[model samples]
Target: MTILPDFRYIRPANVDEAVAALAGKPGAAIIAGATDLLPNLRRGLGEPSVLIDVSAVPALALVEETADGLRIGAGVKLAELALHPVVQRDFPVIVEGALAVAGPTHRAAATVGGNLCQDTRCHFYNQSEWWRSGNEYCLKYEGDRCHVAPKTARCFATYRGDLAPALMVLGAEAEVAGPKGRRKLPLAELFQDDGAAHLKLAADEVLVAVTVPNSAKGLVGSYAKIRIRDAIDFPLVGVAAALKRDGDKIGQIRVAITGSNPCPLPISTDGLEGQPWNEATARSLADRLNKTAKFQTTTTVGMRYRRRVLLASARRLVDDLWEKAV
Candidate 1:
């Protein structure tokens, strides 16, 4: 049986204590729900000597509606977020994404921050320790080469988080707390294109919350994804679309995707503004997404099949949301 490496567990009472713990410990990992981290730990993916638990930080558990839109504390549970009245009324897409994750029990224990900061995964990299050692390991963890792309120096592990695409398309921003104090940045900036080093957060930094702008309010949106199964499996490819209507035309639109690359990516909707919203337009947008997505052999699904399904799913979601808007 695979066993987790020994680690010291520290549960901080507040955000300040949490940040301090991380800054002081050289090999530290911030954990909320442990829904993702524990599984990875059992697989021997990480060997952090210290695990800082921030679930008790009251500041990280608030869900407030301000003039700016909504502020969701990073520690908010996925199940709670999915059932939040404001989220249900104003940001149904976020609710959809939250509910799509893993299973009901996972949602109950998983936090929004945990989902956002979850590690990237690949079939070759997420194997048992013995299995990985037998395969000589991959670039994401121990060895030198990326199993997905041996010719390239980059790791091709995919980020399969459901919330990222949904939150990103709505123009959300991430609030971070660190030794330098607090700062806010566009949520998309939190991630990079590299799988081995995907998150741009410093070792001492902590994700505090996520804020959705008032500009995203009143927009019609939808989230859709295809997975290997109906439950307890990460998405193979996911799509989220949010758009504003200008009478009979499009006012503004944004499309984001996950499980295709190391980072969740936004498909540019440039020049789409003020254009007629129709089936043809949806098809065009879908085609653009299919062309923009960079798929690798990171999952069991064939790249061609993933590409085809992404195109169809994006097209269908846009079409459905447009119909609802009309």
Candidate 2:
């Protein structure tokens, strides 16, 4: 059996304490549920000497409604977020996205922060140390070259977060706390194109909470994904779309996708607003998305197949939202 390496553990009571624990240690890793980190640790992906546990930080687990929209603590469990009545009522897209994450048991222990900031995964990088030792390691691990694309100078691991695209579609903001201070940024900004350094968060920064905008609330939306099985399978491609209707036309619209590339990609819906919702328009947007997204050989699914599914999913989501317009 693969065993986790030895590490110093520190549990902080609040965000400030958490930030302090990670202030000086570049090798320190933040753990909430350990659902994602523990597996990677056992696989010898990361060798952190220190672990800062923020699971019990009270402020990070609270989910409350605010004047803006909703404030979801980063430490909140995925199951809790999925089952929350307010989330189900006001943001069904988020509810669906959360529910689609993993099996109920895994989601019970997985935190929103962990999910949003989870490590990128590649077929070669996720193997056991012994398995990977047989060949050169990928750029995400100990080696200098990426196995997925050795000719390229960067890693091509896929970001597999389900909630990120959903939250991005709804115009969510991430509240990050670091040693210097706290800052709120668009959730989409948290992701960088590089797979090795996927998250934009600094080593000492803690993702405190995610706030959805008030305008996105009550907007008709849909979240869909392509996966091999019904449970416990990571999505091949995931799409989230939301829109506000004004009379018979769309007043505002947003579409975001994940599991398509190294980072979650948001399609430009600038000209979509004020356009009458229809299958033709949706198809056009899907075609544009297919041409715009960047895909690599990260997952088992081929890039062409993944692109087709993503475009089709986007088209279906748009059509569904239009039919169910409120």
Candidate 3:
């Protein structure tokens, strides 16, 4: 049986305490819902000397409605977000994405922050310590080269988070706290293209909350993904789209993709606004999605197959959302 390494546990009462606990500890990691972190720890993927529990931070568990939009605490459970009446009514896309996350049991314990900040995955990297040691490890951890693309000095692990794509499509902002104090930035800016260092957050920074803009409310949106299993498997490719229709023509639209690249990416919808919602336009959108998606041999699925499915999924989602729009 795989055993977790020993670590010191610290339960912080508030965000300040959490940040303080993590500030100078290079081997410290924040844990809200251990759904992702625990499994990785068991696999010997992380060697955190300290695990800071932030689940009891009351401010991080709130789901508040502001005049601008909604403020979702990072510690809020996925199940709670999926069932919240306001979220269900105004942001069904988020509900869909949250519900698509593992099974009900995982969602019951997984937090919004944990989902958004989950690690990147690759077939070669997520293995037992013995398995990885024999395989010479990958670039993501204590390794010299990326097994997926050894010719390049970059890791191609895919970010498989379901909520990030949905949130990105809605133009959400992330609130973060650190030794330097608190700050808010566009959620898209929180991630980079490199799998080894995907999140832009510093070791001491804590993701506090996420706020969706009021302008994104009332937009017809949908989230779809292809996963190996219906219940617990991570998505191979996920697509999210939000549309604003103006008399049968597209007024505005945003598309975001995950499980394809190191970070969730928004597909450019330029030249798509004011266009008729028809097959031709859908094809154009698909073409754009295919171009934007950068698939690699990260998951067990073939790269080409993932690319094709990403396009098809994006096309289908856009067409369906358009048809549903008033």
Query: lDDT of each prediction vs. the true structure?
Result: 0.92, 0.89, 0.93
Q: Give the higher-TM-score candidate: 1 or 2.
A: 1
Please give, for residues 1-326, the per-residue lDDT of candidate 2 as tens digits. Answer: 36888899999999999999998899999999998999999888888999999998999999999997799999999999999998998899999899899799999999999999999888888889988888777788888888788898988899888999899999999999998899999999999988899899999899999999888876888899889898788889899999888888898889999896788878888777888887667766877697657778887779899888888888888888877876
Candidate 1 colliding pairs:
none
Report the C-alpha lDDT of model 3 over 1-326, residue by residue, as the tens digit. 36888899999999999999997899999998999999999999998999999999999999999986899999999999999999999999999999999999999999999999999999888899999999888899989999888999998898999999899999999999999999999999999999998999999999999999999986889999899888788999999999999997999999999999999999889999999988888888888887878999998789999988888888889888988987
Q: Which stretches of candidate 1 lie over 4 Å from their true place?
A: none
* 322: Cα error in model 3, Å: 0.5
Judge candidate 2 against the unseen true structure and give its global Cα lDDT, from 0 to 1.
Answer: 0.89
Show the lowest summed lDDT stretch of 10 residues, model 2. Answer: 279-288
Q: RMSD for each model, in Å, please?
A: 1.1, 1.2, 1.0
Candidate 1 has a TM-score of 0.98
